[model samples]
Target: MHQADMKLCLVLLILLFVTLPAQADNAWQAWREGKALLLMRHTLAPGSGDPAGFVLEDCSTQRNLNNEGQQQAKRWGKLLRQQHNGEITVYSSQWCRCLDTARLMDLTTPTPLPVLNSFFAGRGDGDKQTQALMQQFAIAQTAQPTVLVTHQVNFTALTGIFPRSGEAAILALPLTQPATVLARINTP
Candidate 1:
């Protein structure tokens, strides 16, 4: 290879190694700080929420996390296990996708909170409940880090940001400060 081409290849290799590890370190640091609140937007499920004829009680009537989503959730759980040594509380929306994803984590049996449900439905009560949940979370005194698994709309409503699937947003609560986009984990 030409000297210039070799130099370019070296630069590319250096960037690939340096940049990727830096991102991973940042993510791990965020997890360590406990100032980070990992808010996930469920896993891969092409559509958002359920269709017009959806039924809340029956998951079959809803647009749930598919096989890929399940795997992604499991992968996320593994990552958390490897990264965080501290105790982490896991919460999820009542929806099937959130519930399934939370379960797949296998880290903790998630507590189902209605407040974590989607705000996309534009339900006034849901919004009120969500706000209440946030307030509670903000005030609670827990030593362990907490993770909330909900929909993009709900995550956005809480932190004023939309999180992609399998992506986690870290929020500093109590003051309700701006949240940081941690990492987007692809389980596939």
Candidate 2:
């Protein structure tokens, strides 16, 4: 091969080896540092919040997280424990899926916050509740890392972005303002 071609190939190979591991290490370090607040979409639910005839007050009528989703939630908790010593404050929507996901984590009993539920259910009261929730997160004083298990709509409303099922959007919460998205984790 030409000297120039050999040099270019070496550089490309170096970049491939160096950059990929660096990115992965960064992601791992981000988790270890607990600098990111995880906003997770409830695990493998087949449908959205509920059926048309679903009732907000009753989980039996809603489309909840299934057995596989429950197992996935537990797996996520195990991963967090292994990676970060399992220290996190978990918050969840009152909905069945979100609540179930939070509970399945087996980390802590999550605080049930109605504000984290999706506004897409035509729930008019969610706007005010969402504002209040945002304000609370904005002014939180705790140093422990936080996690929120919620629906896609609520996540989008807060972060202005949509996330898929079982996906986590990491946010950095500063002292006085709303949080900012740091990165996203889509765990298989």
- Cα lDDT of model 1 by residue, 1-188, tens digit: 99999999999999999997787677656556665566788888778667887767899888888788888999988888887866778989888888999999988889998888776766436557656766776742346677888887776666676667877765554415344455544442
TM-score of each: 0.75, 0.78
Writing each residue's lDDT as its tens digit, candidate 2 over 132-171 gives 7677766433466678898887777777777777788666
Q: On a 0 to 1 TM-score scale, where does candidate 2 land against the true structure?
A: 0.78
Leading candidate by TM-score:
2
Structure candidate 2, residue pairs in collision: none
lDDT of 2 at 110: 97
The C-alpha RMSD in Å for every predicted model, in order, reads 4.3, 3.8
Off by over 4 Å in 2: 1-35, 125-129, 175-179
